[model samples]
Target: MSLRRLLRTDAAALIAAHRASVALHRSWVTPCLDQAGFEAWFSRTLAEDYLSLIALERGSGAVVGVFNASQISRGNFLSAYLGYYACVPYAGRGLMREALPQAIAYLFGEIGLHRIEANIQPGNAASIALARGAGFRLEGFSPRYLRIDGVWQDHERWALLADEAGF
Candidate 1:
């Protein structure tokens, strides 16, 4: 597996995955970025306290997923929100299981963040399992915590601290 910062070169692959995974992600939050929107989003993303990356299969060069440390906050409360999705072909194959630990290490060790949180809809068992496998603890649940697909959806808050993330 390989991971790199998302670039214009990755736009097409990202869009394809986004489109293909619509059903899997429909109930999750997203901005539905097309190629142009992706370019625009990338142009503004880093400046807005977010870092996005693409994960690729080692030899095939096929994108396996996307990962992001979004809404970063520094100073005494160094932390960020974690977001990610595995491609249709790679989902349930433990690709995220491999990618997440690396991403978390990057956020905690390189980015110097003390905590990273992933809020997932309760019904997304796969996501919840992924978070748990990566050592995230279920902190609580929020009713209508976020508006996903125009509906206020509930989310279970999961988090891993720098010290506990097994980095």
Candidate 2:
């Protein structure tokens, strides 16, 4: 798998992929970016606070998933939150396990961030396992941490620091 930075030419494919993967992301209330939404949403100049990258199968050139690092803070708290979803065709294929280390490398080594956090719902064993496999440790729990699927949901905080990631 190869990581592709989101580009202007990917808008249509992203929309289609997102539509196909909607069911998988319903637990997170992820927005499906239509053309207009994509226009407003795909601004590339905000690297300081947000970053979006797509995982692609090298030979097939097919999109595997999208990984986002957002809410980045650079001051005393140098960290960001991760949000992601696997494309329908690539779900359960261990694409994340292959892609996350690369994402973590960019966040910690290139972005110069100290930590990357992923908040997961308790019942999402798959997601929790993904985080654990990527070397994120459970940090804490928050009640009503986020609004997912129109309801407040509890979440387990998971994080990986730069030093721990071999930065």
Per-model root-mean-square deviation over C-alphas: 1.6, 1.6
What tens digits encode model 1's per-residue C-alpha lDDT throughout 1-167? 88878787778888887778777677764634597778776885657589987888889988788887788998999989998888778888988888887788788888899999999999999899999999999999999998877899999999999878654
Q: Specify the poorest-scoring 10-residue window by lDDT in model 1.
A: 24-33
TM-score of 2: 0.92
lDDT of each: 0.83, 0.84
The estimated TM-scores of all candidates read: 0.92, 0.92
lDDT of 1: 0.83
| Model 2: how far residue 88 lies from native, Å | 0.5
List candidate 2 stretches off by more than 4 Å.
44-47
lDDT of 1 at 80: 94
